[model samples]
Target: MCIRVGEIENMINQMRKSLISIAEETGLNSDDTICYSKKLDELITRYQRLKMNNKQKINQKLKIVTG
Candidate 1:
């Protein structure tokens, strides 16, 4: 299924929350938490870069239309 930018943003928000929740949990050792934390960071970074690239594309389109 195709995912929209809004969905990506929503996922980013959920991951942000999950990252915080994982940080707060006491029982999990660093070994377990490290994997989860890295995955969240990767997802968030990937989505953010995607969002930025999308913005750049839209701006280019606008410039083409206006020029």
Candidate 2:
């Protein structure tokens, strides 16, 4: 059940879109909605961090192989 980076990125994009729609419709009036939005933001931030880390790991591997 290995998923590719592209698939993971696509899933994140979908979640981002869904979150945006929810925010637009809800307007953050409810505490629950605001909390949910915060969670989504954190999720996206984590995904970005993971992606950056992965890129850095690959670069390190490439550097080792070349050097």
Candidate 3:
């Protein structure tokens, strides 16, 4: 299944909330909190990369059509 930008955004939001809750409950240095933080970082990075790629694709298409 293709994951759209909105789905990734929702996942990012959920991950942020989960990370915050875990840190608050277990302390910032706890292993679980650190793990969630790392996962959140990964999700955010993925989102950024996907958005950049989409923008580049759109630019390429526009150039092909109008250049």
TM-score of each: 0.67, 0.63, 0.94
The local distance difference test score of model 2 is 0.75
Q: Count of backbone clashes for each model?
A: 0, 0, 0
Arranged by lDDT with the best first, the candidates are: 3, 1, 2
Q: What is the C-alpha RMSD of each candidate to the true structure, in Å?
A: 2.5, 2.7, 0.8
- In model 1, pairs of residues that clash are none
Which sections of candidate 1 miss by over 4 Å?
Answer: 16-29
lDDT of each structure?
0.76, 0.75, 0.93
lDDT of 2 at 7: 69
Best candidate according to TM-score:
3
Q: On lDDT, who's better, 1 or 3?
A: 3
Q: Whose lDDT is greatest here? A: 3
Query: Between the candidate structures 1 and 2, which one is better when assessed by TM-score?
Result: 1
Over 1-67, each residue of candidate 1 has an lDDT whose tens digit, in order, gives 5566787778778877776777678435665467677877887777777788889999999999998
